[model samples]
Target: MIKTNTIKSVGLKVPALTFGASGIGNLFHKLSNADAIGIAEGAIEMGWHAFDVAPHYGSSLAEIRLGLALRTLDRDEFVLSTKVGRLLMPRQESGLQNGEEFYDENPFNRVYDYSYDGIMRSYEDSIRRLGTRRIDILYVHDIGKYAHGDIPQEREYFKTLCNSGFKALEELKKSGHIKAYGIGANETEIMMEAMDYTDMDVVLLANRYNMLEPNRDEFFAKCEKRNVSVAAAAVFASGVLVKKNISEGHYEYGKVPKKVFARVVEISKVCDRHDVPIGAAAIQFPLRNKNVVSVVCGVTSIEQVRKNYEWAQWDIPECLWKELAEIGIK
Candidate 1:
């Protein structure tokens, strides 16, 4: 069994493992509501006190299902984080569940909606969907994604929110509605940019700085110097680490490319030499930094959740780190 580590920084006690809610929504494929809730319960039973979800995930139903499962627990037992900057429009000609985004029939099809009104509207909708008076953490999701042909505009919008968004969040925070303010993006440079806009307490670096492509030294250095807690995610690199191309492997992430499979093969060799399962290495790899307060991964079933936790019993030996270091990811 993996002994859960609880971290305390900046007066906030964050769990070492956060179950990313994307798998519940089948962000990798398609999932049903019951399976999602079961995994949520499994995570809690295993000591994961924090769960991160976003409106972009399954049209925000992930949070709703989380809310439903959480209602079965004492609300104070865990932390719930969600994101804004993606608006929920009135369910269009199709219906509430079938609204359009940029004229797409899928209501979950999200475009950047970071205008102040749009950001606030998204927060309000998340509040209703979560069925909570306030959230523990609220992040500005993917301010880096381009929609209006100008990536700078999306950034500028987030900058404005970082300035004013904190003030608004302060109101909620003071009311005990929210715990922290920060940014969550699959990209890294935007997280670097967010430090200037808000008094960020934590940053979610999702898969941007993992073993396959570790190019986040500057970001991690700045975070360490500034006492910012980094929640490193996507450690599996979108299933590239598992290398399903191997006839014996089990993971299937959309479709695995050949080179990704080759690189993962190299990684598996190193892990085997160091006596670590590739999957175990994937779970523990993100916490290499002291500032990485947690690692977030998605699991579809209770069994999957247990498998992820089992990896915590092992750690990469320094020999493995040295070998991985030679691969030149500083």
Candidate 2:
């Protein structure tokens, strides 16, 4: 069995395998509430008690569905984390519509706001949507260049967060509204910059610290120094590390670049010689980093959840790490 890890700030014990709610939000395809709820319940039965969701995920559908699915389960038995930044607003039009960002989802629009009022409102909205008293971990969602794209504009917005948003989070934590506070970003630089404003209890970094791209040692070292735990999300590089072929792979939610494809192919060759499933090695790689507390994997089906569990516990030889280093992976 995969062992659970502790998040010191919240005094919550989480599985080494955390379930991400994006897939249940119908990230790519249409998913019924029953199916999505079934997947969440299945994950809980399979021993995943730490779950992460964002309002931006299916525009509040994920949180609402998660709340319904977990309603019967003892709330104290699980650790729930949700992101704040994109506030969900009811759609101006009343008729059924397609989702612009999230596939087929509820009729809601996302407004990007990271100010004090915005953060507090988003938190309250999440609580109501989740039907939960308190969220174990709260992340300031997508405040950096990766999500916003305009570097200068995002810099100003980030300053707004440092000035107001961080204060709101601190107030929430102090008031027992939230257990811990941090940032959920796809880049490493954002966390480093966030440290300049305030100390963080947790960081949800996605697609940046896997075997194919492990150039985060310095940031991990600083996180260790600050005693901030990390939840490694999208550890498969959005599918590149786990897919059977490069043609079917995706990197950072987009097509795999030629150079990256070549590198993964090389790594796959090494894995082949060692008789290790590349997916197993990929999922297990982040846990080897001392700063990483859990790997938050997205699942759309029970099979994916079970596969993740199996890969997390897969026995890997020490020589595989050495072989990876021998290649130009560094």
Candidate 3:
């Protein structure tokens, strides 16, 4: 079984690895209901019960599929988390067009809303779709410049969140509807700024503090000081660090850049020298930081689920880490 750690602020214990539900949402390809549920069941059989999903993923398809997979299990047997942004609205057209990253999604268009009503409605909607009574963690998804870009419009959204949406999160926590609340952002600076507005128990940080880019010590220190636990997402840097050939995988949800590809090549050489799998190192690197409580990985196939579990459990020599540090990978 994977080790568990308690996010002290929320008093919620989570597994070392949380199952990311994006793949089940039909990212890049379509998946049958049986296949999606099988992936979740496979993770449960391997002793991983924590899951994270978002309304933005397949326009709520992931939440529905995950709900079906956990319908039979006892509610207290697992940890559930989902984001509260981008409420799904009915699409005018009957045909489905491929989204930015998700494919064959439900016939719904996502509207970004970060107001008080938006947060509350998003929470209730997620509950209905997930078929759950309570959610352990609720995150304000993609609220920074990374998703919205640095512009006047982005500042307006941030203002709305600070002015109105935060109240809903606090109410949820106080009313016991949710155990904790935080922001899910890819940028650290925005999260730092958010801390000034409200108290956050945890942050689902993605695409940063990973093997390919592991220079976020200052950010982690700030999180520790604020008593905010971090759940690291995109630990594989969106698959670049895990693939045997760097060219085969993507980075930051897009094609791998030349500069990033070169860095991974050097890291791979160090891994080869120590006979350690690059995927294992990438998955384990975030846990080395004291404030990071869990690493989130999305898997589609049962084989990928088994492989991720095995990789998380793989042992690496201390010398490998030392060499990685020498090469600026740590």
Backbone collision count in every prediction?
A: 0, 0, 0
Candidate 2 ranges beyond 4 A from true positions: 8-11, 93-101, 328-330
Candidate 3 Cα outliers beyond 4 Å, as residue runs: 94-100
Per-candidate TM-scores read: 0.85, 0.94, 0.97
Best by lDDT: 3
Q: RMSD in angstroms, candidate 3?
A: 1.3
Question: Which TM-score value belongs to model 2?
Answer: 0.94
**Candidate 1: segments with Cα more than 4 A from true spot:** 1-9, 93-111, 145-152, 246-255
Least accurate stretch of 10 residues (summed lDDT) in model 3? 94-103
What value of lDDT does candidate 2 attain over all alpha carbons? 0.85
lDDT of 3 by residue, 30-73 (tens): 88888888888878887788999998888889999999888878
Q: What lDDT score is found at residue 224 in candidate 3?
A: 82
> Cα RMSD (Å) between model 2 and the true structure?
2.0
lDDT of 2 at 286: 86
**Cα RMSD (angstroms) for every candidate in the order listed:** 3.8, 2.0, 1.3
1 or 3, greater by TM-score:
3
Which model is ahead, 2 or 3, in terms of lDDT?
A: 3
Candidate 1 or 2, higher TM-score? 2
lDDT for each residue of candidate 2 in 209-267, tens digit (9 for 90 to 100): 88777888789888888878999999888888777666784687767888888778788
